[model samples]
Target: MSQAPQTAQQPVILTGDRPTGPLHLGHFVGSLRSRVELQHTHRQHVLLADTQAMTDNAHDPDKVRRNVLEVALDYLAVGIDPALTTIAVQSHLPALAELTLLYLNFVTVARLERNPTIKEEIHARGFGRDIPAGFLCYPVAQAADITGFKAQVVPVGEDQAPLIEQTNEIVRRINRQVDAELLPEAQALIPEMGRLPGIDGKAKMSKSLGNSIPLSSTADEITHAVKQMYTDPNHLRASDPGTVEGNVVFTYLDVFDPRKEEVEALKDHYRRGGLGDMVVKRRLEEVLQNLLAPIRERRTQLAADPGYVFGILREGTRKSQDITQATLDEVRGALGTFSFDRS
Candidate 1:
């Protein structure tokens, strides 16, 4: 007999990123680092969400296509071992598409519109009445992705917790429709460090806003980005007291710096007056360079052997295809769909 979804041995985790751009520092702090750690203890599946990226980037299909490999390289560079985790491309998995269609029947458009994550995204994209049907139904697709794999845990930012809630609602509806506990509901595992803000101190670090530092950024690029990070505009002189609450440099340092005592001392000094922004920025730069150096080198090495990376993806996707197909077969049978094989 197969194990339960939440079996203590190795629970399944489904988490992924949209292939609209390369991942950045925000991704690392928010979820990627946890993913690296979780792989050792969980059956993890990371999806390259290219199809979802197209909901908004429909006009620029090539951009999404190119970033699929870029995102894959970022994953490999960050120490996500393909041997321990399955890394599959969304478009390559046909079962996910079919499952999405079937799951749509269990959800309503009104509820999709009410999903907090979807609402925020729609407002951010400024898609008022012109929201794409696909974009509005993204939560359904995510439900398909989760239930198709019977994922018991999903790592996501706090803002995305509502989507997981909606996914569970769909799972419950499906169980009622079929009168069987055929699908597993997922729980969101939010990181201790929540969403990282943009360099400009915006609420989000987004590539489209040009306020993000890509994972593949060079030393010079890292330095330049750090220099431009938002600090207290009132702190004109080094001796002037600065606020740490909104200082982006100190925020990055808190997350990236290893010496907690040193960071706390610096924070106290900044609040007390005498520490310059550049002084703190330099420290942050050193910490970031140290953290990203090995990752960048690994990414460069992986990029050179595209064939090897592609092979990993192909093999992972093949494994995922079988798993999803089995789930689909079970779902279809429960829904009483006619299968030629059953004839």
Candidate 2:
């Protein structure tokens, strides 16, 4: 185990999305936008977490396999430059699985059950006592991912901050065992917009729920989704005053509309009276149409060239294998594990 030498190189950031389905506006607002900017300033590794997706989707391995390319397409469509960012598939990295198995020795089952993120997910999925071991131990796997890359920073939603905290805890435990800093502790970089609500006004925006707008939505799809956005139920008439606190339309406006002053003024009008739901919905529709047009176009073009997209993943994963193998060797040495020379 060793501390990384201090250098002027860009800080390394590890962030990723599960390949369960196509990414949506929730993904864009939460992390994708920040990733684009961070690439210029940080050594960014964008992982397509196909293995993590399998923790819950084990029954449908085909679904997990199919969406890896779908998620990668979303990344490329959203301006994630393969030249600036390393976009690798999670299952392709053998060292990560090895690291996960090794790191499990440092964490306990009781603690894993107590993880807030894990707890919430388990309950949400109605797993009860049937939770798969892989599902419960994903935090440990995440710790492996962060440390394998020696990532100094990780971009995630506010709800996921606890996972980063758990990762650091594993890092400290391993350092204490080895009497040296074997891995870097990762800090969570949460987006300012936090989590986006479902168009149906649910607290979570999920593709499975069918309430999220995919990044590749056409203009009509965008408009239709915005039309279904939840606003104040009490404000039935266009002239009636409305509440803005829990209105999903206003929430989307705050995030997507760049005209801050105008949105603020429109909010005031809606709160006082005279603003119709259609009027606000139209504004949101226009804003989203403009935002997603180029992204959808780019995705169509990129989707046409499947070979080019797979080549990017192949190259990135090859580069990642070298880095992770070095880290695994260091970890094995720190634990005094026996190794045979292949040569």
Candidate 3:
């Protein structure tokens, strides 16, 4: 392990999404939008986490495999330039698997069970007494993903802070044993809208809940989703005053609508009792349509060329292996490797 001097080159950033389903508006508000801007200033590596998704979905391997392309399509559609961002498939990076295996030796089962984010997810998924070993150990895989790329920054939601902390802990522990800082400690880059609610007013927008509006959704689909969005139940009539605090429609507008003054004024109108749910829903629909139109167009164009999309992943995976191999070699040297020598 060693502490190298900082270079003039841009810092590395690692961020990714699981290939469980198509990405939605919540993804855009949370991380995708920031990734587009960050690419110009940093070296970004986006991973389609097929292996991570399978931690719990092992029975549905096809789901994870199919969405590798879907998730990549979502990335390309969102203005994440493949030229600027290296998009790799997680399972394709065998070095990450090797790294995970080594790190697991340093971490304990009790610590894995105590991870706040993983605990919350476990309870949410109702894993109960039947939690899979792989699911509980995903944070190790995540550490591999970050350190494999030598990422100094990881863009994620506030809820994922613990995951980064755990990664850093592992890094510190290994560095202390090796007497050098071979791996970089990654920091969380939380977005302004770190988490977005579902259209149905759930705490999170999830594909399983069917509350998400995909980036590739048509105009009609956006309109339909917005139409059913949750608003104040007490404000039954057009003339009744409404609450915006928990209203999903207003929440979407606040995140997506750039017309700050206009949205503020509209909120005031709704609170004062002249605005109807239909009116507010229409505004949100229009705002989202404008935001998603170009993305949908680009997704359509790219989806037509499956070969081109997968080719990007192939190239990215090759590049990712090259970089991660350097780190893996260092790890092997630190931990010692298997060999047969009688020299």
9 Cα displacement, candidate 3 (Å): 1.8
Model-by-model lDDT, in order? 0.91, 0.92, 0.90
> Residue by residue across 46-163, what tens digits does model 1's lDDT show?
9999988889999999999999999999999998888788999999999999999988888888898888898888998999999999999988999999998999999878888998
95-196 per-residue lDDT for model 2 (tens digits):
999999998989999999889999998998999999999999999999999999999999877778889999999999999999998888999887777789
Worst 10 residues of 1 by lDDT: 1-10
TM-score each candidate.
0.96, 0.95, 0.95
Error of 1 at 263 (Å): 1.1
RMSD values, in order shown:
3.1, 3.8, 4.0
Would you give me the overall lDDT of model 3? 0.90
Cα error, candidate 1, residue 71 (Å): 0.2
lDDT of 3 at 183: 89
**Candidate 3: residue 221 lDDT (0-100):** 96
Instruction: Give lDDT tens digits, candidate 3, residues 157-242.
Output: 88899999999999999888888888899998888766799999999898899999999899999999999899999999989989
